[model samples]
Target: MPAQQKKIIFCIAGVLSFACALGTAAAIGTQLWVKGTILCKTGALLVNATGQELEKFIGKIQYGLLYGERVRQCGLGGRPFQFSFFPDLLKIIPASIHVSVILFCTVLIIFALVGAGFFMFNAFGSPYETLHGPVGLYLWNFIACSCGCLIMILFSSEVKIHHLSEKIANFKEGSFIFKTHSEQFANSFWIILVCSLVQFLNTLLIRFAGFEFPFSKSKDSGTVTGAADLMY
Candidate 1:
């Protein structure tokens, strides 16, 4: 292909890939934010549990609620009553959605990065040979799969939390809840914000880099129709 045509293709690919990367970064950041909020509230409650019997009971209840469970058994039999703690699926679903978003964003970012790398090489590489724009597409796909796996793990984690909470809440009825994860409470918002910034930077990089065929190489067909030459 002509130099002009190659350059045009490069430009288009670069723009699209960069956009994908930025989008992914933003997604991860958002996930961190949502998780962080929940963590903060949980952690604060855990830290400030100081009081007499009543205060202790309140603390337990608070923790229990966070994981969507109520206390069922405490002090060994106290008449052995049963209690149930179930999270409103409505709330859990939203949490899961937030997680999904993060994964989606990561996938996009990987795609962009991979594409950029491939294209960058292509534009500078050789001439007369065709190079698939970006194999980075696979990178995103892999990341997405990993995200899905994480989501499944998270689902189990949430279930465990619910069961544990229920057991605790029943022990004394609204007396224990789980503390939020530390990273979520302390670093999520900042992490996500930074991610967004990274995305913006990626965008700028793609725009400025301007796409070009990285692998444009001159044809040496005339040298020989030999198998060795073809392989090379």
Candidate 2:
């Protein structure tokens, strides 16, 4: 690629990295990770509710990493309640797994910002060919992508294997028991998936700018050294 074309590619990658950072930050703050409905098992069983009547015993629940809002339906009416994960939910949910997901999110954001800065540096400023150049770009993007994948995996396990939503619904409720009727990952969760893909796409863009994928050069060099040895 021409120097001017490389510069354009670098600039585009930088912009993408920055956008991923902003999107991740926004996702962490918003209460839109999981969306589901909780069935009031106690109430439904008591009333022996069937079909259409069961709707009265079902409530809606949604949450993010930090805090969330849920509408409790126990056959009487929907009762709105707000909650936080810091201290309130520590006793109920899988605190370790939840905390791990959050830690990875933080890691993803930090790496994304660093990657953006480095991309800009490589584009405009003269950088060291080893650390601050192509190698650095590959390293940052790979780490960010890994972090994003870990975040999603950990969170999914916490929700599915540990029964996160049902536990949250049952917390502090002695008389009424709740069960997760239906659940789906919401917009915020999908955003992280998209951000991870963007990081991957940046790697291809780097290749489009004429940079080799990291480590391939070393293997190629070794092959040439073995060929020379055979001749001797």
- Model number with the top lDDT: 2
Query: Each model's TM-score, in the order given?
Result: 0.31, 0.94
Q: Which window of ten consecutive residues has the lowest lDDT sum in model 2?
A: 223-232
Q: Best-fitting candidate, measured by TM-score? A: 2
Error of 2 at 221 (Å): 4.5
Give Cα distance to truth, residue 173, candidate 2, Å.
0.1
**lDDT (tens digit, per residue) of candidate 2 on 1-232:** 7889988999999999999999999999998999999999999999899999999999999999999999999988999999999999998888999999999999999999999999999889988556687888999999999999999999999999999999999878989999999999999999999999999999999889988887675644675654343331
Using alpha carbons, what is the TM-score of model 2? Answer: 0.94
- What is the C-alpha local distance difference test score of each model? 0.38, 0.92
RMSD of 1: 13.1
lDDT of 2: 0.92
